[model samples]
Target chain A: MIHPFQSVASNSDGSLLFFVIKNSILVYSVKDSNDEFKLVGEWSDEADSTAIIKEKVTKEQQRQLAENTAKKLKANDGTALPQEHKEAKIPKPGQGAPPIYQYIRNVKLSRDGKWLFACTDSDKAIVMFEISAEDKNNCLRLAKRQRLPKRPNAITTTIDDKQLIVADKFGDLYSFGVNDDQPCVNPEPILGHVSLLTDVAIGLDSNGKQLVFTSDRDEHIRITHFPQSFIIDKWLFGHKEFISTMCLPVWAPELLFSAGGESSIFSWNWQTGELLDRFNIAELIQPFLTENHLAPDRFQNKEGNLIEYSVSKIVTFDSLPLIAFFIEATKAIFTCQINRDSGKIALKQVLEVPYNVVSLACAETTGELIATLDNQNSHDKNFVAFISMDVDKFHINQSKQQKFDDFINSRLSDNEIANIEQEGIYPLYHVASLRKRGEH
Target chain B: MRAGMSLDDPSSRRQSYRAKKEENRKELKHVKIDAEVVAEKVELPKKRYYRQRAHSNPFSDHQLEYPLSPNDMDWRKLYPYFYDESKGDMTKEVTIADIGCGFGGLLIDLSPAFPDKLILGMEIRVQVTNYVEDRIIALRANNVKTNAYQNINVLRGNAMKFLPNFFHQAQLEKMFFCFPDPHFKQRKHKARIITNTLLSEYAYVLKEGGIIYTITDVLDLHEWMAKHLTEHPLFERLSQEWEDQDECVKIMRHATEEGKKVERKKGDKYVACFKRLPTPEII
Candidate 1:
């Protein structure tokens, strides 16, 4: 599934979530008690929309605000007052909203969440927005905009947020500075691929000095060192299909989860090209159903055709895999969890979304707050929605864990158990059984 | 007689002194002439003054007369000069360039070879150039052409400078450098045409690698041409590959008057052929 308007970010407190909406960057605060997130601002490139009016107001309002404050003087009561004998007043909330971008392909927030970066394939440039701490609803101050050499296919920022690396459709890798006031300069080209580069991810390697970039053309993920020296330390290749998305495991920097276009996910050692484990989620969920599959009644066309889809994000909740994928043709969201050590997958349930969701991202800290953006939604209204998962209720639904464990224990003989233990296969079977019973 | 033989006779002393000086001059002149004769005899064969039938021609018993004047000689008028009257035979025709062709004597002598090929005498001297031109016109030798270039040509002009321009690259096929002026000087190296640079240029103008034949009475000049031409990048010393390829060397040996001269002298002639290599791609 292709998602043109999606925003992926890790919050300041290490909480990761992404919004797949059109106009505004929805920052989901997963760790904070306030499950609510402030929309920084929304802008659109459409000619007839109110976004253009908002742009004019924001620019003119900022100028007026600065003029009014400059004329302020001390009053008789020792309070600051305007020199023209007028009161200096702060603008009301949401009064001069900034214009939201129209077609956002991908968005990334800084590690501190103070800076927001958004890319639009339509414009072929990445625009940056600075978040204000004083007011959450206030429009994010437009800091800078960097135009890439080609249209960006995927973008990811480094851990320190000092460098932003973007991979374009022509397989050219571009990087820009985050703190620069002018347009970012000096694009460094990364080599190794001869085809279109569809996706890129930046994460610390085992040594924490090299940056790894994954391309869709092949399974080889190139690891490049920081700074301007042209050197490739290693390449990791094991998967047979194009790598759709990759995420650095929160618990282990050495481990990375990559999902392929073949509807399979693999857990690989970042330093070594070892395929620790891999599982096809689509194959595992086919047998458990009563042949009464979820009807295609949810799609806009509603033709009873099975939609083939690939996983987009693989996050873990309490060591259980929480994978997010989109149904083909229909932009509905679905979540499934697989055990890493066991290679078991359970197709839990699918979420009913109002619009076609182009992208998905979940918070890394708690995996509780999940945000999604739909392609059809308007800039300001309902482009992004945050879903709060109830962990207690999820655990309560997995009451069959103990029952499955007992059944497996009763069926295994002493000799069989000893042989299975020797081969290190017992734990995998146990986890598989538990997964079949909806237990983590 | 007793008075004439007096010790203090000034007239006798004067006469004796004059006679002694005359004898010494005569002795010096004879020594010089003897040396010249020895050098010429040792370097050139007497049979060079009379040419014989070429090695390849079996049917014709034509013979060549040496030192034919540049005038009154044409390939068509071969009766008395090249044709053997007793056998009624005429020599075969061939083209040749007379190098250092002073007044075109060699060119005139080799005109019998010109029925099939033209004979040209390249001169580098102004007066000698005029003399050769007048001689060719006066002889009405249609097959013979002479040019006044300087010091290196038949009368004058550097043969090395104009040879490439006069002939297409590799057109001449066979070149004869006979009795080339040996500019013997340690410091005048640039004036020598047989240097490394000139050899490379020669190789360039030669065909698919053709050969350059050098003959000089001066042993040093012959060695110089051999060493430098062989060492040039585009040329290699002709090896066994030249043994069976008799056509190129045939003309050099029997078709030119100079070749006959070398053969008659019984001089140990040094002959070397440097094959031009194919043009190399510029780096």
Candidate 2:
């Protein structure tokens, strides 16, 4: 039922369910000797978020940060950021891009339902919480959680659930081992890439070996061994544009789905390094198209072609076979199913969202239907999701009957259509005919 | 009672529109606009685009309309001062370009310095370009001794988009990026005018051994321009000897309005010049 939150998870028994609502984790216990349900505990990330946001930086912290900035600026007065621009004269470490620390961008719960981990965009840190106990709403006491540095683009438990793997914006993959049920802050940098990594997911090869799948802004999907991440296994390099999200849909975990900054989604089999299918989502979003081009807000950087859109967030909803993802600029969520038999991703459903979906998390405890109800215009309680019981008998509902075509037809008059049709039709090798037509 | 007599039919309407357009074109061919006729119609449409100051998004409202190719542009209108009386034609090519030519100060100084070589200044701000045009026109009208300002013209266009449209291949010998808008924020670094993408365009139109002179008061921007220009394969850093010996470099330092302002404020004006290298041999 916690569909619109940062993360939601139900224990293996489906008796204890919890979701990150705002900064607090609302844990519910469905345990019943004679049919009873109760919220067992609540925990807040208020302190960590406040520290991460940095907008409310204390005077002393501001002073210190300013001094650090000035000293670096002095060093970089006559040079560009050496890391990015290699040819800059005095190449020096710790004097590149200015440090920007931001708040928690994601809240991820471990698969075994033992720990909840989150990563911030700018502060470059991951926080871990012990979410194992069956909680009583606002009644359970908690110990302090550990914080580690690195601006995390995505976080998840490793294949064995023994370590937390974090995808960083600075283009590094770090693995943190769990020591005594608590994730240690010291992370081992196991893998590296050359561009800002957007997302990472855990998947298994055909041989049943656990693998790490990562995507970056450079339009690359890399597959590496779970334990030995230093050795690159294969690169699924098909995306023509930057990849913003990666998902190993539970139903098709063998097929890696990469989206974002693209008009289509690519599904690759990490084991064999083969692109199983490329799903062109343009037709599904035809109604949202801005007549002559793709939606401007989504695909503004379409390199002068102008007609395209960018996908912001994509995630897997466990209970459903479809991929629950949202596209930015358009403010819409689409669920597409991977036809396991055909190895094709077929568009299943599309729902326009209220506001921009900055991030998304799975809520498998919720039913099959991805229902969204817009609440009152309050930051804390605008959108809500319910674990729908009516959608139990769910199938791929690809409603091909589009309502946008009529709208588009209504937008164009007959004269405009005629003018568009008169546009060459075919210029061919008719240079003389072009001159006769008075077309330059 | 025709079957499709509705107003939506475009074929009939297009025929009538074409007939009217031909009639108008015939009439336009017969009629001519003299200076007096132009002045009668101009009326200088209320200068609404003028600003006493420049904003970061000053030219955001400006349209990117441009000629399709080099042949489409009428070069005579761009370089009126280069009208050759002996040949009765205007074939004099523009050998220099001043991008973001704010107040026409650099162009004015270089007009007489390079009397035979045509110089063109591209400005996006409508009123700023209009002001530069008026200054050049006035300078031409007042002078009886020389055709100094005629070889110089200011066009209201984005140099980044329309450089190739205005110039032939390897047409320019010197390109000036004097006192360009800094766009100090890191997010605005790509818009710094000296990016690799734009340098390639500049290199395309600049003759081999041509010089690109850039001067700025902002240290960060100076470093950014220098680094990008140095890294560009088509360009190499000009020596200090050439920097001191070049006449246009001196004009770039002290002639532009921004340069004068920076000088008045006693700010550091970083100047760097790069020479365009010969084209690489393709296999």
Candidate 3:
């Protein structure tokens, strides 16, 4: 069962993968090929929340204990205890109150990976947190708080790292200098989209200058120069419904992929505003499912039913033409390979997850697929899991077992192996496979 | 001939006749001139016109001054007058004189924008002097003024020559120029006005933090102004967060007549602005 709602973001060097769960963010080095995401370090928004709660709970417990002790002494001697003695009682370990709710909507590392920008609806402000890549104890600390005009829908940094662009629900885009002393302000109004902007992607344009791409509720992908000075560059229009997500191809400056609420994915030439290719996954997946229909008896639900689902999230890696999309309702994720140069689509694989998939991200440097699955029985928690495509795992001459064996030998020592064999090996194999695929 | 012969002999007779004739002519002329000159005697004095004297040297003690009104101005004699009737009623508008104005054409073109702004040209050299003066006169510019000055008038003094003596502190609201000679060398740094010392002087003569608009065809000069102006304690680079941000950068490339000339030449123009900062605290 999905145990926690997890979100994954990769550092620029691709040497580390940062995972977010609840109010905590953890970074796991990808050097070792073990499914085990070792706790390199973790920063907790929970600590602050928990500390406040603990203080309140401990104060109340001390007050109650003091009152109770004072009454006992009074009853025994028919006199009140001294204030100093009564106040010495400490709160018991399990008596602390639970933490308040703080949802982590998104977490992004700066281009240099020295800073982390986190946005939470709980505060309605984007907080920039400084982090040290070399020091594990150097957890994320709030550096600056940029308040938005309205609740921010999305935030992104330009490729140049000179500017940070934030879009709000009211269709306002603000550009701020990364090192400006004064609070960032909107220089001018950018007008093109008609509805709430859902996502924003900042990339280099044809001339290698910074360009901003914003997907809005009107099903249009509008691209404009950053800083609002070049407002009339161009626009790309193709989606038939609200564009749910948009991402620039990691390796290609001109290529862009966008998915709409209607289950349509489009490959676009952002520079020339041309629709290079399009595919409706809902239509394509229907025939593939009919051809490979499995008997109902073969269906297994470790956490929930896996049927009645549609693709809700999509991600693409740099080296592969395959797109990984999550079918949330069915708890299954599928990889579809598209021949963009020739316009052909093929369903590569569909694997079942332990719980509902909430989000998906693909590592560009390594073809490791990651998904955030809702934690079963825990409404507020989710687990981020990694899965490797069979093709990516055994690309040329490597067998799956050989890859797994190589990974296990690299991560565990002789004594640990003997202990794992004597006690158990299932967890060990799972860790080995995840590590071999560079998914952790 | 040696003997005392008769005066009628050929050579001796001619000599004696000539001598006698010269003696008689001298005696008669002297007697008649003296007699006639004394008869009509009258006193005569030397005549002198209203000639203003040029300064013995430009750096001497003479102070320059601006004319209160345009009267007997030589610019009216030059052709292609710089101002016309189209300029709004001149009585209400502010008259600004760009002294040492190299190429007065810019002032002529800018005169139409601020229709009420009466502009006067002050140049030193005679060639350009006559050219602009004639250009203004030919255009029948009633609002423009130009004249020659040898001592303390507008036509001849350098901009720095009498700036302190002629203009009061905080008298000017705006001052602008395009492509002033950069004189690029460490030794010639004092020639640039956007320096720390000169900015203070400009601030003094300018209204409280008044705007100084400047543009140059040279990139170094652009950066130079930007750096000095932005670092000055009293001045601030308009933050990027401002709503009307970069408005100056826009007008800088097109509004100035010099800018148009630079554009036609396809040269890059760098523009910057400095608002005179408030005076520093007195210790």
Which one is best on lDDT? 2
lDDT of each: 0.48, 0.60, 0.52
lDDT digits (tens) for residues B78-176 of candidate 2? 664455657867767778899999878999999888887888898876557766765665555455344446678877776753465567668899999
DockQ for every model, please: 0.01, 0.01, 0.00
Highest TM-score among the candidates is held by which one?
Answer: 2
Residues A10-99 of candidate 1 have per-residue lDDT tens digits of: 553434334433443444333354332333444443323244345546766666666768866567897987444333343433757743
* lDDT value, candidate 3, whole model: 0.52
lDDT of 1 by residue, B1-283 (tens): 4422444445566455445544533342211123232232111112222222221111111121212121213333322233345765535222345655654655654544444445556654433444454444334322113221111113234354334324434544445566565677543443455665345345544566565666665688889888877766666777646734745444545544455676788665555676666755322
Stretches > 4 Å off in candidate 1: A1-40, A44-102, A135-139, A284-308, A316-357, A373-389, A392-440, B1-283
What clash count goes with each model? 34, 12, 27
Model 3 chain B: which ten-residue window has the lowest total lDDT? B43-52
What clash count does candidate 2 reach? 12
* Model 3 ranges with Cα > 4 A deviation: A1-3, A12-15, A46-101, A180-194, A283-312, A327-330, A340-346, A378-382, A389-440, B1-283
